[model samples]
Target: MVRSDSAGNGGDAMKEHCGVLAIYSMENRPVAERIVKGLAALQHRGQESWGIAVPGEPILKGLGLIGQGADANAKKILSFTSNRGIGHVRYSTRGRTTLENAHPLDIRGEFAIAQNGTIANTEDLESVVEKEFPILGSTTDTKLAGYRLLQHYRAEHDWTRAFHKLSKELSGSYSFVMITHDGEVLAARDEAGYRPLCLGYDPDTDTHIVASESCALTALHADLVRDVQPGELVSLTKDGLKITKFAAASRHYHCPFEYTYFGHPSSKIDDHYVYNARRKLGRVLARKYPFKADVVIPVPDSARPAALGYSEESGIPMEEGLMKDRYRRKGSLRSFIEPTAKSREEIVREIITIKPVVDGKDVIVVDDSIVRGTSSRNIVQSLRDAGAKKVYMVVTFPPIRHPCYMGIDFPTREELLANKADGETLNVTDLNSKVAREIGVDGLGYNDINGLSEGIGLGKDEMCFACVTGEYLGLKKDPVLRTREEMKA
Candidate 1:
């Protein structure tokens, strides 16, 4: 429903959910610039709007890239002298794209919150507030949650107790970082573990960092500490880090897509290399769904590593099928930003170009995942028009059936193609049978969930598969959207 006219063709140009970065320094050293650079390392996750929360000052946020210009906003943020700070880059999933929805959301006298996942029960929570406290701003569920936290703290006057109480009542996936007026920095991960959060430390400076991925820490020359366990709350203060368990810890469900697409290449997730995991996915796809192809071509950035693995395992030559314009602005143009469906179709054509090596030969196209099937459809059609003898579509991960509430910009069941079809009928069963009926290829295949986890060197129990499995780990109630059908009066 949201539309824009710009056309984005870069590798990292797609929609990301959000990214969070927080730092606690023991030496009171200047870290705003370092924080900004560290966030630049995580810019791949979200680019729509960015903000930094500094102690004893107003939160700084605006619409632009992090490492650009010497403007007032940048000067204001860089000038802030704080030993502790939090930064956020957001991609709107629950709320509209506006300055109000931008994170590091502050409740004047109470707390400033920066979040990285969707609050699934936002509507229900908002309903509770509409019936209880006086409403403040827009209909965004994020602000609603912030208000609830503030209201709870005001009544209880205990930050820890209020956080625990509110965590119990909220439903959906979220990893939150909050700074209280009392100078305590609190971080909490969702029980489902739908999103990734980790802690790292710079022993040299005695500074601790929390970010969406391990790569950010590496960029800041910080040592990798343990991941923030699900259902656990970590508080960073002058006395050092103190962790407390709130809700019963659920089975860890690290989103499988993180390795395949979202995470940076150099990053290590759950002790596994993201690039290596993707390559293993390719290898698994080749073994599970072996297809005779003359050459393997990746869909672009996210699929490149996996495609190489497929080529290595299958002994097929890998070719650079599509070229990306790296200079493209991060948030300026996007495939989904096309104003109309026809324009969206045309934008894909202008962006991708097939190599001449595929002419009169079978081609295997590897992509990270397919949500609505529109992008895949167009890619296949373009490859066919390039004179390929046959086009086979291979996705690195299994079909994404359930909408992701933990973050990743996948909202509403109506937009998911897998949700409409049963598992048995999916391409993995009869690749040719389904591909003949579907657009863009003679066959389509995907890596099995188990195979993907194995390839990543982790067990299903350790990673988040809720987007693929629909089995949320911790919350007792379903998301507000899912419960809407049953809520009818």
Candidate 2:
């Protein structure tokens, strides 16, 4: 396996996108403080900006990490005295990385919404809004969706009805935590459950928590309530919890990337332990792409569990082929606060140390996913320089070809390695082959889509495989979709 030289040496880390945390106090206790704490735990998900919206008060937000002075903003927000609030920590993957794009986007009367997925048909949606409701600010599709909903809700004057209408019109993946002015906290998962949203309980305070991961609830000593089922709308109000179903029923395609990369190791999604799922994926890969190697070296952190499972399944010893320097800073200190491609490359080069054991050995590298092939290419080059005799790469997920509108940040089609080349040029017959050649590897393998779905204990129909297969299940062709199709044509 290839290694990122910058694993342990702490320059800057590759960060995932935004995390959403919402809390509604059943007993009307001070909820803002709890929301702040929960967002702190989820800061690993997104680090660029943080915001919180409390009823009857102005939304509070700013640039930078959640802990670094974000607590002060939370404390300030706590002064609002609202029992229902939605908080967001953003990592700008699509829109401009600016304060305007920071979330917990509030509309005056209808609602305030925080979202975790990217809107793939944003260009189309934006056109509809510009012609229909032209007063909206910010470039994010999230804000556009919020305004569209606000417009619908103002006319309908019913939260559930407005949401149903908006869901029908929206395209792409989104798990939303929305707060209505009527003091209702509504949580809706995307039709395919592409982004994670779980429910939990704070027994002592009798509060209800909804977050992108279970780990946030655990940090606040909350009990696991349940995962918000796909295509389900959960409403929490002073009355109680209520569920409303919408959209055409289809199989849930939960994002496989969650388990392989984005999800926290301690979290559980769709009832399966995330870390355990990765290990199972590794085990499945070993069975499907068996290779005789002297050592199984994980790509580090994200790939560790799969590597362990691979070693156990292949009867190969797992060795730490790459040593991470925990203390070194790679580039400009400011870049760590806001990571870029240049910063990430520098971090990768600075963080890893090669082990003597891999110098003369045949090695198998296990990784979560390969997006553009650049990171994997760098890792492979680093390993070759470290004296590995042979390097084989294995990915836990299939090649990603399509851009994700439901929130996973994949490059556009033209930039995807699989989309750009045929089997011969890519070197392998499948995803594994394309990745292997891109990174200059002797052999490459990827877990088939079925293998991945089954390894996670989910049936093919129960998970969102859109990113893997480009087949959207519940998406409807509304005005936005139609207009976008016309524009493209």
Best by TM-score: 1
lDDT per residue (tens digit) for residues 416-470 in model 1 = 6665545434556653345434555788886777888878888877776766777
State the lDDT of candidate 2 residue by residue for 437-458, as single tens digits.
Answer: 7779989887777878867777
TM-scores for every candidate against the unseen true structure: 0.87, 0.86
Q: Give stretches of model 1 more than 4 Å off.
A: 1-16, 68-72, 130-132, 155-158, 328-350, 420-427, 469-474, 482-489
Which consecutive 10 residues in model 2 have the weakest lDDT in total?
1-10
